[model samples]
Target: MELSDIRKEIDTIDEQLLPLFMKRMDCAKKVAEVKKRDGTPVFNPVREQEILDRISAKAGEYGGAARIVYNTIMSESRALQHSLLGAGKDLRQRISAAPKAPRRTTNVACLGGAGSYSHDVLQALYPQAEPSFFSRFSDIFRCVEQRQADLAVIPVENSSAGSVSEVYGLLMQYCFSIIAAKTLGVHHCLASRTGRIADIRCVRSKDIALMQCSQRLATLQLPLSEISSTSAAAELAEKDVGIAAVCSESAAQQHGLKILEPDIQNADNNATRFVVISKEMCIPDDAQKISLCFNVAHTTGSLNSVLSRFAAAGMNLTKIESRPIEGKDFEYDFYLDFTGNVHDPKVLELLCSLEDELPRFHFLGNYCEMK
Candidate 1:
């Protein structure tokens, strides 16, 4: 067949695909309604695993690239589900379920601009919160410490990368509690003013941003410069010539930059988890978890002893982190998150026991269900 004939056939196929895509989205929306009614989580890891396996099994039938189709479809499915359950639900709801009057205005401080990932997570988690943006994580924490900001959002860990040690160290010094938690998928790209792939000179990004895109960047022989953050890199590109930034799409739009390329991270499954911190304790409705930090006595089975406390109380522990106490060479403080609100009888009993046994202790916060 002639090339024009082939193009016409492809166009016809595209016309058919659009309707099917809309049908799929409609079905996805129904799924969201079911989940909300049943109080079931929107994300199903087991179902996702099954889909991956089924796709891999059919690799031989799709012209030797079965894995590609599986991945693309899985990604689309996840994105669709996320949208249906997240902002879409809010839009669909008839009432303006805007947040209740802040028990007190939570002046939250976070790294970067209005549309940065941290900011996005904050807005989702606390729609009524009054957010204040800071250029650095240290600055964010300081705002909370000085009462300039009532709370601060800090990235603690990533699924692809490991724990953020700097934040861990800061946690030890600050008198703040891990009041809440949020996990966000990190989708990055190489954004610039030009669409051409070859007209790039230097790629500017933060250290973490570069590390996330290391494998992809290695494929292209270009100069790499480290900046303060992904947003800063993007801002720099707006003022400089022949420069691009490895930043999020939200950041690109906020900085008035265009996406020359998208999804340039080394791994498609990149995600970051952040913790909300505040100087004062927060008690919210639907509270399920209580966080505490303390130092164990110098003795063997000390860590085990702490774990036994939860077991004794019939409580489940969610997180445990140890950090070195400043000015003390060997001493360490352990942070713990366990099931049960502070108001629970068993939880109160556990706290009383820990106070009698442990040397130092601080209660972070009892977080309510954000969903």
Candidate 2:
């Protein structure tokens, strides 16, 4: 057959597909009505799998593509069902009713003392708030958990060294709401009282900090110890001439140590992203970022289905990371950061769908992010 004839036939098939698609969608709405009347959930994984299985068996060589098409169509069917039944209405109301954050919070917890990078974040956002510095990341979480502080400002990721895994673990453990985030430039320096690289025998800093400066630390041939924070390392380095701390220049100055070597981190543009966590959810009018953690079904295409919802909504996913679910052996929980204000109708609907359908779904927070 000629190419033009094939195109004409394809056009004819496309014309036929539209009416069939409409009929299927109409039937899907009727199913929703039945489900609503029966008080049944919108998502029926078993039924969906059965349909996929039967279709795949008949489609032969195009099974995978056929499965994808049905997945999308069925996903849209579920979406319509969810809408008709007003799924996530309660969640939407609660999110909409969240109180706006105060103009100034009174108490704040951070992971370092004096001149650490976390302190810089604190100074930028909550300088007026009473600052309680903790030695460990867990301590910061505990401080908030115990209501000793109103909020905890802690590092979540570094530009070069990657995520602060311990902090993420703590976040999962505590399940606090992230209210805001900030990113600050990092400039790691080898600081010591001796002010001499030759005199350095040991190096100490936060694990993330040491990792950021691993290349520089290798050339010095010094033993490294993981300390609570970069500032604490500087404090330790100040009292011992043989120890050097990989910390910010400001931290060294605060602890009466001199900067022996400056800008030692691997990346010139190294930065750390910090999150301000609170016990309550607060969505400001101008909020533009959302953070959530949850697990999808341990089945094929489950994660893809969840991601597809976001894509269909025209939402942008900025970051995603997985950590082992504490007791679930090899299974994991995913942490996702996406760009959307809860006030947007489509965004709210998508979030509600996720809250309703996903397992262990936690709407961490919808908040404004700062650079």
Stretches of model 1 off by over 4 angstroms after superposition: 1-102, 127-130, 369-371
Residue 278 displacement (Å), model 1: 2.2
| Residue 222 Cα positional deviation in candidate 2, in Å, after optimal superposition | 1.5
Count of backbone clashes for each model?
0, 0
**lDDT of each residue in 194-265, candidate 2, tens digit only:** 798888889999999999999988988879999989999998998999999999988999999988889999
TM-score of each: 0.67, 0.95
Q: Give candidate 1's error at residue 6 in angstroms.
A: 78
